[model samples]
Target: MGQLLVVRHGQASFGADDYDVLSPTGEEQARVLGAALADLAPDLVVHGSLVRQRRTAELLAAAAGWDVRLREDPRWNELEDLAQFAAVSGSPDGLDRDGFQQWYDAAMARWTGGEHDHDYSEPFVGFRDRANAALADVADEGTVVAVSSGGPIAAIASVLLAGDATTYGRLLPGIVNAGITRVISGRRGLTLLSFNEHQHLPPELRTYR
Candidate 1:
């Protein structure tokens, strides 16, 4: 059986000018997670092409002291949040955190509801399909670790667990930054062993954003 460990990128610069970059806390989180992952001795390390994802992968690899070259894959990148936000009406971009969450929730609900097929940046079906394909392509014989965003990580988990679109939608908000999701693929096919683990991080280090 081959092991697949999917990691959500550390906390990003939410609400900042460049949201693709990781925050200082995020860098620390990645370093801590990397040290723990080093013990696993992953045969391959992979990440999406996004800046935040790439930075997380690099930081973790360095902290782990693993010399493996990271495999860049765009299919593992996050769904387009700006596109989703634009699809909805009423510019809640300037709203407070609580207000924004409400607006964002409604927007996500509309997206996952399958109402706007042509409206999304990347159609939900395409996103789901690509996520599955990416996972299959990286199923190495030994342990494999992939650093990506929460959306792709959750999408893959939802598929392997036989969850529907609603399950996938529900998962996005709960994934902790720098959390790990483990799976095993063999003749029997992919099986999810764990989801959203961050026990290695202290209370102050845990975050979701």
Candidate 2:
């Protein structure tokens, strides 16, 4: 059986013109996470093609001093409907602050509820399928670390937990960026061993708001 460790990308420049880049704090977070997992010596390290996700994997590899093979897999990319939501709703920059919360909440509601069907972005079903395929590619017997975004991580966790789509929609809210979720392969299938573990970081570093 294989062990899969899913990691959400470090903090990104959310709401910036180039949201693909990671903030300075995000860089440090990735380094710290890398140090935390140094002993694991993962056999395979994979990340989404998105810059932020790839950067996180790079930073982690640098910190861990491991020359593990890194693979770029697009299936791990995030659900990007937020960009469309911002465009349609006229959301301003800097979602880490206050005012963006209301706009984000409304947009997330629409995105998750499938009300944004007409929006130009990946549909929920498509995102789920992509993530599931990426997870299914993991080989047995060695640890695989997949660096991805919150949405894809949640989607994978949902499948591991409930075996269907409806449960993912209802349970994905709890996942956070830079968090770790563990899945262990077994006779039955992938078993979700943990979800959203961030105890390695201090209180100040833990931010899902």
Candidate 3:
């Protein structure tokens, strides 16, 4: 059985003008996680096409002293719904944090309802399909680590566990920054071994945003 470690990118610059970049805390979180996972000796490391994801992988490899080749795959990218959310909710520009979360939750529901597949920024089913395909493509005969966002990681777990998008959405809030989810692929295909493991980080380092 080959192991696939799906790692959520570190805490991003939430509420910033550009949310794609990693914050100072995010860079530290990635380095700490890399040091923690150094002994795993992953044969390959991959990340989504997002800047945050790529930066996380690069920092992780540098900290871990792993010279493995890094690969990029857009199929593992997170489900983007910011534009769709704005379209559905008249924009959350002036909303507070809680208010923004409220809008986000409702927007997530609509996106996953399978109704706006035609016009959503990214179709929910297509996202799920691509996440599954990315997981399948990397589960080779060695340890593989994938750096991604919470949505794609949750979607992967939900699909492997035979659940629906609701389950995937439910997982989003709990996935810590730099958390790890383990899966194994064998004769029976992929099996989820663990989810959201962050014992490597202390309470202060653990972040969800």
In terms of lDDT, the best-performing candidate is 3
Error of 1 at 69 (Å): 1.7
Spell out the clash pairs found in candidate 2. none
lDDT (Cα, 0-100) at 42 in candidate 3: 84
Estimate, for each residue in 60-145, the C-alpha lDDT of model 2 and write its tens digit.
Answer: 88898878999999999887656778777775576655677678766666665665666746766677878988998884747999
lDDT of 3 at 150: 91
Identify the leading candidate in terms of TM-score. Answer: 3
lDDT at position 159, candidate 1:
94
lDDT of 1 at 106: 83
The RMSD of every model to the true structure, in order and in angstroms, is 1.3, 2.9, 1.2
Candidate 1: lDDT over CA atoms? Answer: 0.88
What are the per-residue Cα lDDT tens digits for candidate 1 across 9-120? 9999987989999999999999999998877778889899999999999999999999886889999999987666665545776789898878888877777777787777
lDDT of 1 at 158: 93
Report the candidate with higher lDDT, 1 versus 3.
3
**After superposing candidate 3, which stretches have Cα over 4 Å from the reference?**
none
Assess candidate 2 and give its lDDT.
0.81
